[model samples]
Target: MTSASRTFIDHAVSKVPAVTLGFWIIKVACTTLGETGGDWVTMSLNLGYLVGSLIFLAGFVVLVSAQIRARNFYPWLYWATIVATTTLGTTLADFFDRSLGVGYPGGVSIILLLLITSLGVWYRAEGTVSIESVASARVEWFYWTTILFSQTLGTALGDWVAGEDRGGLGLGYEMGAVIFGAALVVVGLLWLWPRVSRTALFWFAFVLTRPLGATLGDLLDKPVAQGGLEFSRLYASVLLLIFIVGCIAVLPQRAARRASAA
Candidate 1:
């Protein structure tokens, strides 16, 4: 085989999509959809948080199973699993924060612990938690578990910052979006310096996108009196889904280049 062909195959080995502008666009949109769609199921539909969590959890299990079983990167399936995780994260956060009376601050604290633990364990077992190292089923399991925790943490953290609690920034949705957006910009800039760890930056960007989505989603769907446009959750979710599909179709998507552990 030609060297060029070998290079292409090597890059195509990762099931996860390469970190790119298109990837971020879809990821942020998916998280936004998770917020609105979860609300649509739980609040607008009157199913409550527990039911919503169960529903999304089931979807996550099924889609993630399919994603793991697949031999190559399938953009649609990969994205579907992501949406399932974010949606599950949304409902689970609500259940813990509201139903269980843990509140946003408490929820954020707890989820962050889980996230840290997941990464620590993954790194210990695999020697690295980098996306490029995700080549085996065992590593992918670690990958998805860490993602699930991160998504949950993102939702709780986003709500904590945007909420009116005295312990948090209480910045509201618009300001919350601005804060995460600026943070993401800083991470992107840090990427330019080679000394900075790309794996670390990638995960930072990943976690940051969810809150950006949470704030943006809440800004669109919450009542006008609550500093939002009060759009119907179902309608907002549909629009976000359409945008995600359109981006996947229009933009380039390819798997990450497989490499050594960090």
Candidate 2:
């Protein structure tokens, strides 16, 4: 498709899936895989966060380029980019927490600030933070940056909650997941109620899902010694990956049919 035609049809194409149950299911799966797969590459192999991050960053660049080049939304390509973000987020968050010795709270605070800044800048630049406006390159850049920050923030928050007496907030991973999940329910109710910006509500839920998934992932894989079920990280991560692939395979992920005028 011609560049002009591609841009026009983009609007008609699905910018994002509906905020339904399936979306959250896939999202948490991706997030869990992000936690374990990232650890597999970085900690298991002893590659170090810097080297692991560089690898994932390169992958992110390639996947993002492919995503942007597509004439319409391709589920594989789009979701691949998301996986890239989560993996990258994993190593990046570790870099901050370990390398900088910022601890989980410090890392979470810094990443959260950056996320807020990216959103504020994007909204100021284009007057919207809605996914529906994620067509142009400028908005796309902002979108990806915000996503990276949110994922990283999720990692930090998960660590903070699940860690033992670190910041005096030791709810453990299961409890953390429950808390975040509860918060999500409240947010959903608020969104369904009066006076919430759909755009704002969407982003709020988007950010919360990351931590929810992160904590849940840790709860499954961390050792019983560490308040988890002692399940193998690889096993849990693989299961999540299979579920994600199955969902993508069965779901109707196609973009809308193009209009003749476009």
The parts of candidate 1 lying over 4 Å away from their true place are 1-12, 165-168, 260-262
Across 1-262, the per-residue lDDT of candidate 1 in tens digits comes to: 5777555445435678888899999999999999999999999999999999999988988998888888889999999999998999999988888888878888888888889999999999979888877766787888888898888888888899898853566788999999999999999999999999998998898899999998999999999987999999999999999999999899999877665322
Task: Please provide, for model 2 over 13-121, each residue's C-alpha lDDT reduced to its tens digit, 9 standing for 90 to 100.
Answer: 4544545666777887898889888887887788999999999999988887777666667777777788899889988988888877887788888899999999999
Best-matching candidate per TM-score: 1
Note the residue pairs that clash in candidate 1.
Answer: none
Each candidate's lDDT (Cα)? 0.88, 0.80
**True-vs-predicted CA distance for residue 208, candidate 1, Å:** 0.7
Q: By summed lDDT, which 10 consecutive residues of candidate 1 come out lowest?
A: 5-14
Candidate 2 ranges beyond 4 A from true positions? 1-15, 165-168, 254-262
For residue 86, model 2's alpha carbon misses the true position, in angstroms, by 1.0
